[model samples]
Target: MRLQVKKWNLSNHSDYEKQCGQYCYKIVKTLLNFLKFLKNENDNFNSIIEGKDRQIAELQAKLTSLYSNEHKPNEFDSLRKLITESNTAVINELRSQFLDFHNNGEIKPPYDSLKRCQNESTEYNTKVNESKGGETYIESPYPNSCVPFGNSSKQYKINVAGAGSFHVLCDAHTAGPGWITILRRADGKVDFDRDWNAYRNGFGSLNGDFFIGLEKLHYITKSQPYELYVHLKQLNGQTIHARYGEFAISNEKEKYNLIKLDLYSGTAGDYLKTSKHTGFSTKNKVNIQYAKKFNGGWWFNDYTKSNLNGKYVADNNLVGMFWGDLKILNLVKMLIRPKV
Candidate 1:
């Protein structure tokens, strides 16, 4: 019985030892889990703190840049002022060099040769390159939209007498607001660089367009068939393609003093007088006027050769002088005598 008691006590002691080892293992595993959790929290806090520090550094750099004078608003103001000053200087230069007929009336000589052609009509001294069938070959100098004359599959021959005054008429009503002019150049050879006189208006001035004087074909005497070029230029000073074509200006019978040119097509009625952006009719006559050489290219509308302020000028714009917005359609030379 003693032996049995001792064996039972030994079994009890072994069971107690096994239970304590299990408890110790469980506690150690719990503590290790808690330590891992703390480490994760510490890593999270450290990452958050680093992100906030980066943000603060960015803000500090931005503040430093704002305070720097190199990026100040006044620095930009200086650039703006420089641009404004440059524009003003350019405008002042143009004002000094620019010359208009309304401003500079009758003047003598000693002016620049190019500007001289603006008023002097007899200053044309260059000959043009001859064209076959009097067709002018032209190239445009603008980078904008220009109303094109419909393509001509075959060129037609409209003979203008080298003698007497020749007239032209465009009867097409243009859709847009644009003015046209017939540039009368003496020489068929156009040198845009050297022959500035050939490009000058009568009285030898800086302005080449809007000129009506000796430089233009205002008055002419009988001569051989001259290759007179017919160029259509813009009057509004817009950078549009200028219409260009040439017709054989040969000598013809001086039966009538005036030759009224009409559009060969029925388009003659399309072109009429316009004022303040409104179109008006010209009862089969365009306001044909003469710009005298002495008057510095001022228009004369009086039908009377004596009166320069023309009265019956519009009675014929077909083959005469007037700003128009029409295509040079068919060439129909219809001669009309001026009423006394």
Candidate 2:
């Protein structure tokens, strides 16, 4: 069938255009608003992710610390045991080396034996002190003195700060008629006792006497004050002497004093003597006299007649003249004392 043909109308077309324009505008506005919402969501998501990451890192650190603390005791105990074993091994090795040295004859057995005996004696004394509920009073040997127990030839010197007694010991190969002269610092200068006059004047000669001068002694006393004891022997095998004892000095200036001890042996009773000039010259002289009873036995006489110059001499045989054990208060007092 033939249908009626409808024509397109202008008014209807205008209305359709207006409606389409309105729908497009609505879609554009919705899209813009949605995009803004999505941007905000992305920012929130990133912040949440970062917060989670930080929490995870903190947990990991705490766990690591906990694990370390849990395992520390075992590690510390193992390390401590290792150190203890190492120290013991080292001590044993040293003991073995010491024994080997003795066996090889590198050093004299008598000296070694003496050292071991001293060690044992020291241990015994320590034990005795412990048993008595008291601490042991271990006296240090004169500072810087070449002790007989060591291998080096360098001697030690000690400075005594005050008036006190000191015992010095020395060892030498040869023995003969000799004299030991102990001297003190009288006027801040070092002087030899008059007993050394015999050797100095060539009256009695010293053959194997090892003369160590005051400059060397000063070096010894720079770190620690005192001089090494000299072993003086004569040509004749008439007398033998090993002088090891203490010397005392009163506080003149209260400065640390220096002294020298000489061990000499030659003629019978060759000891130190002093002569005083009372009237004109007022001069004093020290002389060496012979002792008839002790063969090489010498007396420390004439010490009073010698000039007491406020100084120390080089060849005085006085132990602990350089280093003395004084109470802390006493040491302070001595250091602050006026110079003579």
Candidate 3:
């Protein structure tokens, strides 16, 4: 009787062991399934974040276009502010979530991708803000500086017959009351080492350092004869100018050729008048070797004597904003007006 009781207890113990093993297997399988679900969720989250980032990038591009216009509507400020705030909030929220996931020891996050997105957003904002020349105001309907829109502001907008409308810094108190500043380089805040398209379309701030654009220049001069004023400053605070009685340029098909530049009279030497160059050359177009050799854009023939768009400071070659033998100038400005 004792042997039988021992055998029965052993059998029951074996059955109990089997049942425990099965339960443990089920628990492990359930845990594994849960982990897989969590991993999938993490991947989905990352995909969603990436999608949002793409959307934000698209919006940023559009924003850049809106702000690139020198002139803006009255509602632009408010609209831009709202969009910026909203984007900021979204970025902040995404950052917070990313940090939370990282801390929780969940699936490994794409930290580098998130960092790249943040940096891009910041850079875009900075560029947009800088490109927005200045405050918005009602643009005058004058054809050019010749038609005076009296006392509006230091910088004002005018419409050219073929070039549409754009801003210009009026020199009401400088050499003349009606002079319109086309190019000004008070500092190196703006980069002038650019390609043909960039030089043609123009860049920089009108109220600060800027270029009035080549296409616009062509139309403005084409509509009527205009005089040129080349104002320059040395590092030692001395200022000089080169005034031309007549100046004009050809259209795009002609590579914006320097059609006429004559009757020069100013303290600064007539370097441009002496040069035999006829067309504009940028860093990537026309006379590529000379443009690259000088490290900037200008009218280049066999050689170049003046490269106003060169490096801000003189390099080893002493190639910079120079005229004649004067190199590495501190400041320079070019103004134009109807030859009245």
Give the best candidate by TM-score: 3
How does each model score on lDDT? 0.27, 0.30, 0.72
After superposition, the stretches of candidate 2 with alpha carbons farther than 4 Å from their true spots are 1-143, 148-231, 237-239, 242-244, 248-270, 273-340
- The count of backbone overlaps in candidate 1 is 39
Clashes in predicted model 2: 50
Question: Which pairs clash inside model 3?
Answer: none
lDDT of 1: 0.27
Q: What ranking of all candidate models by TM-score puts the best one first?
A: 3, 2, 1
Per residue, candidate 3 scores C-alpha lDDT tens digits across 52-124 of 6776767666776676664433234444455566556656766676677668846465666657666765665
Per-residue alpha-carbon lDDT of candidate 1 for residues 1-340, written as tens digits (9 for 90 to 100): 3554322233687876776675567898888997786577546545544553464354345434433433422233333343344434433433343333225532232234323222221111110111212333121232111112222211111222221232222212321221122332222222211111322222221222122222233222121111121222323322222111211111112211222222222322212111112111122212222322111122123422211111211224333323333322211111111111
- Candidate 3, poorest ten consecutive residues by summed lDDT: 70-79
TM-score winner between 1 and 3, please give it.
Answer: 3
lDDT of 2: 0.30
Q: List candidate 3 segments past 4 Å from native.
A: 1-140, 150-153, 314-317
- TM, every model: 0.18, 0.20, 0.56
Candidate 3 accuracy as TM-score = 0.56
Residue-level lDDT of model 2, residues 1-340, one tens digit each, is 9997644344787876776675567897888897786577546545544553464354345434534453322232333334344434434544564455567635332344334434543443343223221333233444323333343322234332221123222232222211122222223222222222322222211122222322222233333222222222222323222222322221113211224223323332222222111110111221223221111112223332222211232333422121112101100000000011
Best by lDDT: 3
Q: Sort by lDDT, best first: what order?
A: 3, 2, 1
